[model samples]
Target chain A: MPQIAQIAETYASQIFWLLVTFGFVFFVIGLDMVPKIEATVGARDDKIAGDLATAKAAFARADEIEADYRKRDADARSSAQHLIAESKAKAAKETEAKIKATDAVVATKIAAAEAEIKAASTSAMAEIEAVAADAAREMVAKISGASVTPEAAQQAVKAALVHG
Target chain B: MHQFAIEPLFGTDHLAIGGYNIAFTNSALWMVATVVVLWIFMLGGMKRELVPGRWQAAVETMTGFISNLLTANVGPEGKRYVPYVFSLFMFILLANLLGLLPLGLVGLHPFTFTSHFTATGVLAIMSFAIVLIVGFYKHKLHFFSLFVPHGTPVPMIPFIFLIELVSFMVRPFSLGLRLFVAMTAGHVLLKVLAGFVINSTNAGAGFGLTVGLSSFALMIGISALEMLVAVIQAYVFALLTSLYINDAVNLH
Candidate 1:
């Protein structure tokens, strides 16, 4: 039979690391989690603030555009009277120009919103992919004892997505 | 080659490493295997499919187990910490059970399963403690002050600090010992019983075969018992870890 005392002596160090790893894990959870949550909250706060700022600026821009439209519209109205007495073409051209300018600004804002949403979605998906791949690497090592390359993980992810 | 001895070499007076007794050791190899296995167990089935396949489902169960644990102990604020807690449970559980596999990823050859305290195991516990310490540091002075109990007299400061220090120091020991003892005891029991079966079979009575059959039956029963012990020990380790963190974080 092997000596128990000898086993203890030899294993003392192994025993030490196990305890160490255990503590690190719990430590990460207990400590890092709170700040992560705070960061999330902070991000949300910054987003809300940005949104409010953007809306305020948009309102200011819209006000200027409306004032310009009204001025141009009144000018067109006065020109229309002249057209009735003279030529209608100039009044119609002024109205057309005002409509085009307002439509351009609205379209620009729509495109920007779309771009922002697409960017956010793309980043979120990529983050998900990375995390899933990491978890897969670990699992494959445990279950199959095979080292999987990143390309393989991507393939596995693709396969999962197909089935999913 | 001679038949392999199921028993491990625990200690040797002849071999010395750093003035401490040394034996041909194999536990570290098993730890590497455990780490690899743990990585697999955690990462496998992580496709996050709405309707998970078998592998994913099994992994999800473990994930859910850890997630639920963090949620329960640390509250909603700590739910995000599920990854760490689950990873911890998996590491401890896998390491504890690696020895039981007759030919787990790598067979328990003489190079492994031999007795020697390995730093890998110590790494597990120390890493755990360091995480807590770091967490405490992250939480800053508020966390350090946790060592002092509220409403205590000013005279009790040093005494309290000493008690808390000793308690924190023992955290790894308690965590490692619980897992180590459970595993070692279970395997030793299995070995001793197998020895009994061998000895009884060789005793050469008319009823030797009958005795062997009974012993074999007992061995089967013991295997089942060990399986339960394995899971229980894992739970105990994880639960204690959560409690320790709760104390550190909330500082109650």
Candidate 2:
């Protein structure tokens, strides 16, 4: 019985720890372990979020640089187009001026030629009148077969005019 | 090595306290020792910091297990009961596992030695009772008529009443017995196996080694099995407690 009692004592200690464990578990429940767990999870979540924020910022920065380059290229291309159009317009204006200047010179030459022809026409008409006068006088004298005095000539001119 | 034997509750003479026989049992000693050890463990862990040592981490794991259990099973309403559940789980878990240790009855005659003085007695019974009482107390008047379902036929009500009553009365039994039987059986099997090993070792020269080795293997296996059972029984106990509470609160 003494030996048996001693053996029970050995097991007794084991049972004690068991009871203690039970008490502890129960106490933990009473103390509200849920919120503490939440707090732990919350802290972990915050850390992940912080990391994500950093990653996002870096990504945004990379995107911004890419967008900046694209914008600059677009601007350059449009400006180059604008410059090309301006040059084309200026070239057209210069070509038009040169053509108008050439047209004016040609018009001036035509006007001078027209004036010279008018003067020549006037001289030719004067010569034709002088020749016609001489021919007519000589024909009249031949037809009359006499030389007449001035008064007689006048009368003869009158007669010839009446006869013609 | 000292041999173990079971001592009866009363010797040839009875010890009387208020007309009830009292044995200054190994049970009382074990209970006190468990308290002291738990207290030490708690104090060791309670200096909660971001970086915890091994013991603290282990304690925290236990706490976390119970917390998650409550959150998963009983809903957040049972969130406030974390400590109680945790305490319940730890107590039952360790108590079940305690049988694995070398605590046995000691005696003079080798034949007289037997295993006894289990922790599963008054302490476990009382703890479960306290849980039931407190659970009901929390629910108050709402706890009564818990068996009576909201709607039933007038004629069939009595039959339902009896069924419900029986089920209701069976709650504490199932809850308490689950732990008691599981712990007791696990320990008893280990003891029986140990007896066989001892007997075999006493037989022959080379046979001792084989028996010892087999015993070791068996112990290891039972240890692992008991460990699982410990947690499971605790879970069942806590789960039932919460279920009863839920029943009281809903009481349709």
DockQ for every model comes to: 0.08, 0.15
lDDT of each: 0.62, 0.59
**Number of the predicted model whose DockQ against the real structure is largest:** 2
Best by TM-score: 2
Docking class of 2: incorrect
Worst 10 residues of 1 chain B by lDDT: B1-10
TM-score computed on alpha carbons, candidate 2? 0.59
Global CA lDDT computed for model 2: 0.59
Instruction: For all candidates in order, state the fraction of native interface contacts they contain.
Output: 0.19, 0.29
lDDT of 1 by residue, B1-252 (tens): 111122224455565556654444355445556656665654444454444578756765666676668678867755655556565666656665665566634643522231222432453464467447856766876776667778878999999978976877777776766565566667777777777788887887544578777878988998888778867777776677776767666776
lDDT of 1 by residue, A1-164 (tens): 23243445555434433444444444543244323433444455687899999999999999999999999999999888886866557667888899899999989999999999999998987887888888899899899999999889977876896788
Q: TM-score of every model? A: 0.51, 0.59
lDDT of 1: 0.62
The true-versus-predicted C-alpha distance at residue B102 of model 1, in Å, is 3.2
- Superposition error at B26 for model 2 (Å): 3.9
User: What's candidate 1's DockQ score?
Assistant: 0.08
